[model samples]
Target: MENEKHHIVPYRVYAIVLLVLVVLTFLSIAITDIELGSYTVVGALLLASIKSSLVLTYFMHLKFDQPYIRIMVGFVLAVFIAVVIVTFFDYSFR
Candidate 1:
């Protein structure tokens, strides 16, 4: 078997990512105070997506992993978003 190349990410990058996630979390909470109606939920979901992306890329090592793995992850996320859209559409129509 061929040896796979390993990409070692720096600790500082992880630290920054963590900091960003924490800030996003706080922002998500803070946004709940204002009444944006439907946009509020959309904002929260957007923040959640950002947090998930950070976790997947840094914590899950997807950022340094192989291209195939990244591609698969992207595909899964796309499917998830599509499902969410369909569910929301169905509910809105009712």
Candidate 2:
């Protein structure tokens, strides 16, 4: 029973974080017409990234896992970001 208690605590924390992320996602969508300018998109994306990280780390069981997996995930994320930046620059320049 003691072992089960140790395992369940992290899950509870993950569930709370997931709930908060859902609330934030809904709130962000609801406030779309407020016109916060450039920051509006930035804020939404930042929140989304946080939500994704939480899901990946906890729900996906990456929190207490291997370093190689983290490195691969980080590399993929970096590549994705690079692609986005490149596309943005291309669109802006053209």
Candidate 3:
């Protein structure tokens, strides 16, 4: 197998990502306090999704990885989303 060159991300970028993740965590916590009724769950889910994407992109080095890796990640994410949707649909009906 051929060795692939990896991109070295700067410490500053990780620091920024950490800061953003902290802020998003706080935002998710604060979101629970708001009186959005049924939308509160949706709001929290949105924030969580953003946080997950940030972790996946930066912390997982997906942002700097090869295109093939990104394609595989996309496929996996699509399957995950589909499963989540089906689970939620089943829950909503019951």
The lowest-lDDT stretch of 10 consecutive residues in candidate 1 is: 1-10
Candidate 2 vs. true structure, TM-score = 0.78
> Model 3, 7-70: lDDT tens per residue?
7889999999999999999999999899999789888988999999999999998887889999
Q: Candidate 1's residue-wise lDDT over 20-52, tens digit each?
A: 999999999999998999999999999999999
Candidates in order have lDDT scores of 0.93, 0.78, 0.91
TM-scores, one per candidate? 0.90, 0.78, 0.87
- In model 1, how large is the Cα lDDT of residue 41? 90
- Measured by lDDT, the strongest candidate is 1
lDDT (Cα, 0-100) at 12 in candidate 2: 74
TM-score order of candidates, top first: 1, 3, 2
lDDT for residue 45 in candidate 2, whole number 0-100: 74
Top-TM-score candidate index? 1
Cα error, candidate 2, residue 17 (Å): 1.5
| TM-score, cand. 3 | 0.87
Note the clash tally of each candidate: 0, 0, 0
